[model samples]
Target chain A: MNKVWWKILGSVLVIYTAIAGLLLGVPRLPILNESIRNLYFHVPMWFAMIVLFSISVFYSVKSLSSKSEIDDIKAVESVNAGIIFGLLGLVTGAIWAKYTWGQFWSFDPKQNFAAISVLLYFAYLILRNAIDEEQKRAKISAIYNIFAFPMMVVLLFVLPRLKDSLHPGNGGNPGFNSYDLDSRMRMVFYPACLGWILIGYWVYTIRFRIRSIEVKQQAN
Target chain B: MKKILFSLLLTLATVQLFAQDNGVEMADKLRSDGKIYVVVLCIVIILFGLLAYLFSIDKRLKKIEKENFPKN
Candidate 1:
């Protein structure tokens, strides 16, 4: 976790994304136009969020077996970091929707499901705060987290596709891959996902460290 | 017969013109004027600034950890 190289690599990759994502050529779809560029900035946020939430679940499972406070801290801090990315995803998606889909908050299945999934994590945080006893809090919240993770996945990924969604790749609509995600866009999009995921992990580690420190300080 | 040939040529010329105008529009004007670079530079600067801040926080936390837990 303390390794510096990956953090530096992430920073460099993100900076590269900021420059290349804007300058690079993209598909010339009619409604999307230049806003197709949002693929680099917006889609990656959810990818990073999903990754961080996965890490949170892993730590939660560890906390359950080991009954360790440190593992609990890791779980909760990762959720906190993941929530930040999730919110960013929601806001960015809304802004993109406004211009392309003609509304900031279309009742699109994907958008609604995304919002609900983020709320699920919010409930996880609240669940933690509601409990006071340390061991009970860790154990119960870990169990809740394990359940929440799968629910989030289904809500965001599965339910949207099952219904009619204005968002791409849902319902009967073909995804960007079939139409707009040409090879040129992939060059920037893939790197953006990787870079943001790394940065999200970096943020999670920092939050974990700080929270662990606070726990230690409280003990002393 | 001559009139038919002339009208077919006219229609072909109009079709070519229509295709050119039908091309999808993008922010080509901004790119050509060189102002898109300004947006990119500003975003990069903000990204660097936030990253630097995060790094400093990480360093400070490391220092505090060492001081607080000397054995670990």
Candidate 2:
């Protein structure tokens, strides 16, 4: 697709997926019953959060090592987007929990880990704001951002794997793998994930552009 | 001040949550599927897209900067 066409396509896909996710994915799931449909929205938000956070880390590393102002902007914008997606993920997950787990906020290991990840990233933003010097802010935030990224990965992925739990997919609980998620569900779920993620990217790009403009205006 | 406020909010949340059931273990079990790798892959793809967009923005900004501040 041409550039304009690509942008149009992205926007269309986002709208289409959102409608499909709500209308179809949530209602038509068979395996794990209707509750499993939460994956369509909640899972994608988490995925977007991870993606944006990793980009923040990359920019952080680049900014610190090379002292590139552009890198710092990217790092900041990525973190902002990551925070937004993380909050969405948490909220949606909580709603899903209220229905399935019969509670809103649980101290489950994964949930705690998720919360810690959010707090750590939020602190990264605060650290950036606290520093006065541009270079120093970039350098310090970069280091912390890198550190936070891996910590989140371990908390959300590795640590949970090492334990058995009350969650559905953990502790040898029967999950999507063994569960009978049919082809119909997969159609809506995969696209929904992609569409939300693309929408996330659109937001990040817009924010990044705005930051870049601000930097240019400041320079002038 | 914001930090202090956040901490106080967090503390309140923790206390309130403690009064209720802590379903972390169960929630973990429910969400801890092998689909994590799929999540990782999706994350990587999104990152690449964002990175590419950032690079393009930087280039565009540099062009604008040169236009506005031509160092003659």
Candidate 3:
């Protein structure tokens, strides 16, 4: 976790993606046109968010089992990092929607659900702050994190698909995999997802370290 | 009336086919003009700057951790 090699690799891969994503030949589909390239920049935000939230839930479960304050801190920091990525996903999705879907906020099922899931995390953070006792706060919030993770998955992955949505992989619309995401695009897209995920983890670790240090200082 | 409606439908179908045949408009001209590189360079610079800042923060945090927790 402390290794520097992965961090360096993540930076290199992201730089490569930024360059290649713009230069690479993408599928020329009507309506989507050049904006299809946004798949590289926009979609990865949600991927990173999901990965970070998964990490948060893992730590949350560990905290519940062990009753450790550090584990609780880890869970909270991961959620904090995940929320940043989620917001980025929302903003980028909105911008992409504006050109393609004809509006910034279309009240699409996917968009509405994404927003609600983010609000759900916001509630977790608020719930954490509402508690005054240390162990009590950690225990309650960890349990909340456990519930929030699955709800987030259902909100993002399941509910949207059940209803009509302008977003891909939902409603009647075909996902990028069925068409458009050809070999040429995959070269950049996969690396972009991985690079962003690594970067998200890096940010989470940094926040965790800083928070840990602050906790130690308070104790001393 | 049926003939007229059928002809109109055929015309609409031909127009759709023609649109597809023309192909989806991409930024081919921008690529050929060699200006896309400029945008790529600008984004790379911004990314580099952000990563550098993050690394510096990590380095400083490591220094503080070392000073505070010598045993660790």
Clashing pairs in 3: none
On the 0 to 100 scale, the lDDT of residue B25 in model 2 is 36
**What lDDT tens digits, residue by residue, belong to model 3 across residues A181-209?**
99999999999999999999999999999
Q: Rank the candidates by TM-score, best first.
A: 3, 1, 2
Can you tell me which runs of candidate 3 are displaced by over 4 Å? B1-34
**Residue A65, candidate 2: C-alpha displacement in angstroms:** 3.0
Determine the C-alpha RMSD for candidate 2 after optimal superposition of all C-alphas.
19.9
Q: Note the Cα lDDT for every prediction shown.
A: 0.92, 0.72, 0.93
True contacts kept of each: 0.75, 0.00, 0.75
| TM-score, one value per model | 0.88, 0.70, 0.89
> Where does candidate 2 chain A have its weakest 10-residue lDDT segment?
A1-10
Using lDDT, give the best candidate's number: 3
Which structure among the candidates has the greatest DockQ?
Answer: 3
Q: Individual DockQ of the candidates?
A: 0.56, 0.02, 0.57
Top-TM-score candidate index:
3
